[model samples]
Target chain A: MSDIPADLRYTKSHEWVRTEEDGSLTIGITAHAQELLGDLVFVETPEIGAVFAPGDDCTVVESVKAASDVYCPVSGEVTEINEALEDSPQIINEDAYGAGWLFKLQPSDAPEMDELMDADAYQAHVDEEDH
Target chain B: MGNKTPLYAAHVEFDGKMVDFGGWDMPLHYGSQVDEHHVVRQDAGMFDVSHMTVVDLRGAGAKAFLSNLLANDIARLKDAGKAMYSCMLQDDGGVIDDLIVYYMTDDWYRMVVNAATRVKDMAWINKQSAAFDVEVTERPELAMIAVQGPSARERAVPLLPEDLREPSSALKPFFAAENGEWFVGRTGYTGEDGFEVVMPEASAASFWKALFDAGVKPCGLGARDTLRLEAGMNLYGSDMDETISPLEAGLNWTVAWEPAERDFIGRKAIEAQKAEGKARKFVGLILQGRGVIRNHQAVNVGDETGEVTSGGFSPTLQASIAFARVPATIGDECTVDIRGKGVPAKVVRPPFVRNGKSCID
Candidate 1:
């Protein structure tokens, strides 16, 4: 299984959202998603301050061969965007969880994190997909 | 069951993104395909090409057999270790597969065919060899690696065993030197100077790791496709398959017509079509605007309409380019239908990029 930090909550769409102590959540794609997509050439992230409903299409990740849509896992307002990706889109491929984080959001409901997959459950989900 | 190459485990070790390509578990890329593309164009990179089958044809009639089997004449291989690129065709002039025939001796010739076409090619070769008493042996004991780029030869030459160093280093383009069981040929699919080395399967892992340590980046099929397309080389299934003729796929140059009496299998049908004129012609296109051109995109040339056979962003050119099969009579201007809208394009000869530079102004 890929390295899944216990502090982060993950979505089935292969995105990880880490809830910071200040009640903000930092989001990015998971290692499995980046590995499957190969090298990322372009990424279209959601705008800062944009409010999104859970399951809404919020971003796009395009590799050399295919394109994938990144969905919002929880209803939240995007507060910040990773401007670093504009010049170094490959940072996402290199470090999907940290420096490659896509956006920071002010969650409409902090309790929503309970609905996301825990580290162990997410690992099991990824492992079950290996077959 | 399909066979896996010796580098299969190594690919997983590198955590390469795997895909089922032509039936083999092959790496699509290690991490970033764009980076890998730049690695080859600017520096050095290697690909696990062992999935490609290397078969040896031997017998007194080996030359005669190939001369009849392939569209190109093998009798021209006067010197041993010389290689000839040819297209094998069906009786109806349809492409069976395109391959390289290496002349090792008067009685021994080595043929390397695409990975996907191995079974059909083996069966066909065996059938044809029966008439000439030739023996067809697939060499699965070997693994193949393609080290490519401007700096490829420099990096790969020093990694060779001492016995192979001198002769292999002195080998010319399209020539190979066989030292014991090791075969080093100055060849590659990417449009760059490099070597395609075939060595014993057992030693492949160590050699691959050494090349990696020498700074030869590990690339996968993704970079290979873009590199070949930018170089104007055709992919077997996408450009032409069992139903497509080489004439329509821009491979007419590979067919030899001399020895008028020595008819290869596909000659008659091709000759008949050559007389009547073929309908479609393969040509390269440069996107005139911002959109990325892609395969299956429709081409609009007045009353003529065709589809893109292959298309991608050319890293070297920094512009989208494509190959399309359109009406043979179409001119230098056309539009590619992308997402319901037509995008203007200019027709051009391929090699969109060469040696890490733009092929166009």
Candidate 2:
């Protein structure tokens, strides 16, 4: 099983987020998402200052077989995008929760985290999806 | 409930992501598809290609029947262990399916065809064999495993039962030899050295486990696609279907036109097409700029338009590549429409990467 740090929250679409001390959030794909996508070939992310509403398509991840859109878990303004992924996209497959983080965002409201699933809930959600 | 291969339970044990593949519940990946692709390229990887049907053709006139039924002449395979790649075609010169015909003996020819085309191929073969006294026997009780990589031979050779080692080791590319019930072939879809082994259904699980114990990484359909694309091999449905001809699908070389007098099913139609001229030529394209390539995307070549048959990001090249069927007049320069924008590309003959080396100059 992949490491799912208890402090991070997850989206139904398989993105994980950890709130920083500054109240900003760091976002990366979940381990399940990376596994489903196989080998990631290309990634299209939002501009640094771009603003997104809840459920907006903020990023795109592509594998050899298919391309999928990554939606924003909550409304936010993009702060930083992962520079390392430009040359090494496979990091998402290796360390999805840490170094593989896709972007940093200034959330409109941190309270939105309440709507997201915790580790046990996300695990149950993933388990329900398997059948 | 769908049909599962012998490795089905193992896939679940390993947490494989299962999907419906042509009515079979097969693993699409075992957690990381990219890792599997790399494993096959760098070390050894095994695939459960058991979904592909294996048919045993026997009877006195098997050779004569296959020559008339398939586009390629079977007589060329005079050696017992030799194999030939050929296309089973329709009367209109359209490719029905591409397959490998293995010559085990004069009275027996083993054919492995695509999973989706099994029903049609069987019906067509049986219908055509009536005049030549050939029997079509489907080996549903058998399972196949393809173990491929640069180190594949070294890893697999040692695992074989001692009695078959000598003959199996001496087998050349595109050749198969049977020792008892084990059928081992040097042919593979990946652009790597390996063996495709076929054994009885009862023995498949044990053999698979043995290979697994021997350290062969289990791969799935996800890696298989990228590997075959890098190798310049075509997937039957996406590359050429009932509507497409083998000549335009980069498979004309598989057709044999010898004996000047010997006629195959699609000979006359292909000859007419050859006389009239082939309208499209299949070529490989390398993206010059950033972006990914995908199937059915438009390829712009001056005044003509082409279509991408197979395309994806090549992990080896770290760039996007595609196989496209464009106008015969299309030049080396073309543009592939990515999303909404047209991305410039350079047309080159395929096998974009071979033996872990870049094919592009």
Candidate 3:
């Protein structure tokens, strides 16, 4: 199983959200998500200042053969996106939870985090999908 | 579970991620496909190609039957152990399958065809050989391994049969030397200098282990596809199928049209198509900017629209490249409709990479 930090929250689509001190949210795909899509060759992050609804495709991650979209977990405007992913998208494969964080957002609804699954619940969800 | 190759267990032990390819369960990758691609490009890598079909034909009519059966003339194979790549075409000029046939003798010839087309290939071979004296035999008990890279031949040469080792090591491209059940072909799809070894099924895992110990990394079908794409090799179903003619698929050289006396299955239709003209052209595409190029993308070459038959990110080129069947009037520039965006691409000759070097600027 992939790592699921207890402090963060995750969505069924596999994006993990962590609220910042100033009430903004830091969002990225979970480690489990990166494992499913091997060795990302290209990453297309959402435009800065663009608005997105929950479950919207905010980023496109690609391997050599296939491309997958990264869904947003909460409604927000993309305040920042990981510039490091532009040239070296493999960072997501190396460290999905840390430097591979896709974008920072100012969430419109703070209560959306409650609807997302906790670490234990997300682990169980991943386990159920495995079988 | 699907059809398993003799080396399936070894693939699992080597951390291969198994996926169902056609009807067979095969390795997609051991770990990272990109890493494996680099290994094959720089050092050496081995692939379990045992899932590919192997056929042996014997009898006095072997050469004559193949001359009529394949689009390319096997008469070009004058010497023993010389191999020829040809397309088995339907009577209507459509491709049945692309295969490599090696001339062992006037009475004995060996062929290796794609694994997915085994059933129809066997049925077709049997149906066609009924009029000739050739005995078509499917050798399912044989396993094939492709060890490829600049240094791959030296590493595999030591493990081959002692009697055939020296000769096999010195084999020219598109040639195979054999001893007993072992057939070593100096050919590969990866656009690298390598050896394709065919051996008994029972000894597959052991052979794979020996190569692994010799530092030849095990690569999976994922890396295989990317490698072939970078090399600009045409895949059977993807590049050309039963509905597509080899001429339209950019394989004019593979068709031996000289010597009007040599009549093959698809010769008439092919001639008619050539006379009619306006045939579609097959060419390579290199994406101008970011984003991956994928198959089935509609290509806009000026006013004419075509489609990408095979496309992917080329790890060697660090850019996305594709193969497209376009109108004969296609110029240097084309636009690929990728996810509603018109991504511009350069129309160039096939073979985007070769011999561990990028062929394109």
Candidate 4:
């Protein structure tokens, strides 16, 4: 089973979000997403200050097996990108939830966060995918 | 559900992430694919290749039968226990499969072919054998294990039967020795010195356990692919199929053209193609920039476009590499389209790495 922190929010596409003190949201793929991808060899982060609508492909994570797109969970402006991943993509495979965060976004619509699934709901979604 | 090998239980016990491989449930990796790849290149690793099809050809006409069947002349394997690599071809010059034929004796020759090509290969072999009085027997009761790397022989030799140790150890490359139920060959796909052991299916588990206990890391299909790719070895489905010819697939050396009177399947078509001199060239590419090269990626060589057959990030070189079929006039410089962006690459001769060392300059 993959780790799903109770305090975070998730999308069916597998990106997890945690609201920062400044009301900006920090986002990264869930552990379950990374596990399914195996060992990550490359990560292409979206440019900072770029705006994206919900369901936009904002990033790409490539493993030895295949490449995957990381979808944006909500309409938002990218405030920061994970520069660490440029040299160390395996951090996502090692600690996907904590230090492996992909980017931070300043949400254009805070109410969209409420529409995302909670930890329990995301866990159920992962279980459905497994079966 | 996919079929399972005799070592399926061992794979599950070792925390293998199982995936369906050519209708067989096999491990894609144990935990980390890169780790397994490094283990095979640096030290020793073992792979359960029991899913590969093993066929034994026996009859007074076995030599004559094989001489006409394979692209490479099996007559070169005059000594017992000698092996020859050849591509079985269709009448249209397309490859049926590439296999290793080992001359065990005057009456018997053993062949190991790709697992995915079992049905077509057997049908073709059987159909061709009718005129030669050769018996085509598929040995499903046997299991195969490949122990590869620099230290592979030292680790595996101790586990063999007492009488076979000396012969197995002294076996030259591309040679095999049979003792009782054990058939050991000093051959591997990893570009490392090692042995490929074929034994009874019932004894596979215990042998695997003994090898594991001797510190041979259990590798999976993922590592096997990367190792082979780095060694410039071709995968049947990815590099070539029924539609591809050996000449266009960088296997020209395997074809024997001497003794013009002797004929083999697909010989006429290949001969015509050779006479025309317009066959495409197969070359290796080293990605000159970021991004991993993948299969089916578009490659631009001058004005003509080509396609990548087999490609990946080579762990040994720590750079992206691939095999591409380009126009015969292609030069050293080319570009590959990765996600719509053209990236620079350099074309070079293959065998990017060999015997734990980089073959590229």
Candidate 3 C-alpha lDDT tens digits along B1-361: 7999999999888889899987998999988999999999999999999999999999999888998999999999998899999999999999999999999888999999999999999999999999999999999999999999988998999988798789987799989999868999999989999999999998888989999999999999989999998898999999999999988898888999987899999999998998898459999999997899899989997888999999898889888999999988998998999888998999999898999999987
- lDDT at residue B185 of model 3 (Cα atoms): 95
- Complex DockQ, candidate 1: 0.35
For model 4, the docking class works out as medium
C-alpha lDDT of all candidate models, in order: 0.88, 0.88, 0.91, 0.93
Candidate 4 per-residue lDDT, tens place, B1-361, comes to: 8989999999999999999998999999998898999999999999999999999999999999999999999889988899999999999999999999999999999999999999999999999999997899999999999999999999999988777789999999999999858999999899998999999999899999999999999999999999999999989998888899899999999999887877999999999998999558889999998889999999997788999999997888988899998889888899999999999999999999999999999
What candidate 4 gets wrong by more than 4 Å, as runs, is: none
lDDT of 3 at B359: 92
Candidate 1 lDDT score at position B191: 84
Q: For model 1, what TM-score does chain A reach?
A: 0.96
Location of the lowest summed lDDT over 10 successive residues in candidate 1 chain B:
B288-297
What DockQ does each prediction reach against the true complex? 0.35, 0.59, 0.84, 0.72
Name model 2 segments beyond 4 Å from true.
A1-6, A108-128
Superposed by TM-score, candidate 3 places the C-alpha of residue B322 at a distance from the truth, in angstroms, of: 0.5
At residue B353, give the lDDT of candidate 4.
94
Q: Which residue pairs clash within candidate 2?
A: none
- A1-131 per-residue lDDT for model 3 (tens digits): 68899999999888999988899998888899888888789998999999999888989989865889889898989999899999989898899889999999999887877999999999999999999
lDDT tens per residue, model 1, B191-234? 88899999999999999999999999899999999999998899
Q: TM-score for chain A of every candidate model?
A: 0.96, 0.96, 0.96, 0.98
Give the native contact fraction of candidate 2: 0.60
Compared with the true structure, the alpha-carbon lDDT of candidate 2 equals 0.88
DockQ-superior candidate, 2 or 3: 3
